[model samples]
Target: MAEQLLDVIVRKRELQGDGVVVLDLTRADGAALPLFDAGAHVDIHIAPGLVRQYSLCSDPADASVYRLGVLKDPASRGGSAGVHAHLLEGRQVQISAPRNLFPLAEGATRSILLGGGIGITPMIAMAYALEQRGDAFELHYCGRSRNHSAFLAELGSAPFASKVVTHFDDEHGRLDLAAVLGQGRARVHMYTCGPAGFMDWVIDGARQQGYAEDHIHKEYFQAEVDASGEGFEVVAARSGKTVQVAEGQSILQALTAVGIDIPISCEQGVCGSCLCDVLEGEPDHRDVYLTDDEKAGNDQILVCCSRAKSKKLVLDI
Candidate 1:
């Protein structure tokens, strides 16, 4: 999808919980924001070269402001830390129009939203949308603890408060997957987002309980790209530059090392943000964003994670 840039100002910033900050953003011109659905997110330009996607936690019906929760990640490469430290009230930040990779499933009789840690952001938005439609949906949110969890008051005070369930690492221990999802059936749709480990557990549990793969949806904030491809060479056809991709590095990294920057986000290959045209060569597509026909055509490749199946690839970068 094409991204349209929007200039916004941080209208308010508040500490939501331990290491978590919620920022209320509004258009720089003080206009109504674009309408967005549940599970929508925005790519905030945090620094000169740092852009990060954050789930919008505000009620979708509210077009006046966009609410985003950010967790200060100690292991952050730059995005989280930059947003946490530099993005304050009155700060000017560039944001992308909202995009939804984790939208609610259409025409579902029931929904179960599962979240872990910082993953609660999207779940909150889903709860708001579901409640507005008067749909029967339950939210199972797991965080480190009540102290570490963000938006407790907001999530609890929501009109569908009774459907919200909380699990704390400090008090209740880890979420018992089998116990919580034992009733998962194909008819009931499921949505999950969070850390890789947490999402894998939830998806696996639901699958084991007879939930069809199509009935379970997932969104990952960060994904460890599969660096298992053999080393290859990528030739930038237009730039006439060739770079050797080491076994552990991606084609995107190899190209960037030579000072050729390609727009990239969700390097995990979910957003189709780094898709590039393959001028001449085959690719070992390792992304979930591309459709089967797109992959079979081998005309475009997500350079963030996918690699060349041939020894070398001529790219239309």
Candidate 2:
């Protein structure tokens, strides 16, 4: 909701790797899009009621176009499937201005970029920016295999190719997390994105290596939490209705089940689409949308992935 929606045209589409499709999008009006830094992402409107957030994979310096890589998962809820099936070149699409939550550390002496599977999207942009600035940086990309890895050719030809390392599970055996992050990484700020388990493993390794939390930047493609039933009550102050948020469900689900419609997207918590005002009670802020300071205030919450820490929550719904 921070940026207005714009129409963009899919200029090109190509297979980046197994089940991954790369889309080259440009303004439908042939105008330059908003400038964005590395690690930025745009909310893509799939259907009237379906929207998803995808990281910008192209170089930030290039304002003429924005590139996104999407993984077409067979088990997904149809976001990527729709893109793969219908979002072909020349198709028109709706998107919001790019927003960045996983930005590089401004003061780090060295930078380490870790990517896994389709998570390489943002890392590619970061690599370009870091290389352009002549910063001390290295990129380590991992995947199940070369066939399933996206953008391998691009990474190999990157300006910082010499600093790029590849680790394919089929060939390299499960990543030697400790060895890759063993030493010297303490001085380098790290930025990583991937599947929940993969990112968690990488983050845990960094923490075990004594990396400062502030220097370890991460973004989750999906929420990784036991959102199971811890029964809680929600007091919808606006509607004057009390609802029981059962276990194994989200706050948003509880509201929607009661016919309380809320604007939401990327239920994973990465996008700030489901943000709501909290009139009372403490919120278990789990979403990546809000900053630490914002979470501390407990005045707002992203209902999609957050829950009530207190027994009852008074929401401005």
Candidate 3:
């Protein structure tokens, strides 16, 4: 990977409750940074040993700086806590160019945004984009408590504030899945980001409500495992090489270890960037990106985090 040394000075920091820290970064090099669309995220080289992905929370029209919110997850693998504890004002860090996988679609008449806790990060940007285009939309933000919610003030100031509903588990109880889905009117396009369970719940509800698969969009904050087992061998037809993937490792990680370059985003298997042809063998479809018919055709698989079901599988790398 090509690495660049850029000094991203921390311009300001705000605590948005629930152990989440919002950091605003600006370039110290006095050069205009690359422009990014709403729902874009950047990879920050937190320290020599840590790299973390954070969504861009600022308006895309402003190229002066980038805003990111970090939640100090106690159960985290250390990345979140590191940002909260170590990243401070006046500190400089290196950041990758912004990348976006959750972009707003064109020609949608109306929008419905569902966000859970920190998952609101990207959805917030999408809401802004839709509002800028004068699109009608409603935002449903669910969290454990008001104190646990981030960007409450900003969300309340949005043009669609009256359309924004906040559901607190502590007060309002759990979100009424039925009510949210039943409120649908007009041709509404749905966008959601949250934990696996939350996403699954909304998706299932939408399906039951007769929402077309294309109309409901989602981004997973975590991977969902409906199945699990030991790994096997995968043959890349184009590279003409085979690699043995062991248990506990994803096929994408295994292939990359063997020096094969594949473009990938959201290694959690939500994004379809790492999709490749499955020329032969039964694939244990575990990714959310492909549909049932697509998987049944045995045409492609997401190598980033998917494993093989058969003892040996062939791929058109």
The count of residue-pair clashes in candidate 2 stands at 3
Per-residue CA lDDT of model 1 for 199-308, tens digit only, reads 98899999888887788988888776788968999999989899999998999999999989898876888778898999998999988778678899999999999998
TM-scores, all candidates, are 0.90, 0.92, 0.83
Q: Write the per-residue lDDT of candidate 2 for residues 174-280, one digit (tens) a residue.
A: 87877777664546888899998889899989998888888888987766545854879998888877899888788898899888988887786777878889988
Error of 1 at 150 (Å): 1.0
TM-score of 1: 0.90
Highest-scoring model, TM-score:
2
Q: Considering summed lDDT, which 10 consecutive residues are worst modelled in model 3?
A: 219-228
lDDT tens per residue, model 3, 1-317: 57565678888988996888999899988676788887788877777756767888776766888888888877776578778877899888888888886777778778888888888888777777777788888889989999888889988887657778999999979988777777454587788888788888888888887778778887765675433579799998899889988888788878889899887655666657688988888888888777779888877888876777799989998
What are the lDDT figures for the candidates, one per model?
0.89, 0.87, 0.80
Q: Over the full model, what C-alpha lDDT does candidate 3 score relative to the true structure?
A: 0.80
**Segments of candidate 2 deviating more than 4 angstroms:** 1-3, 184-187, 285-298
Model 3 vs. true fold: TM = 0.83
True-vs-predicted CA distance for residue 236, candidate 3, Å = 4.9
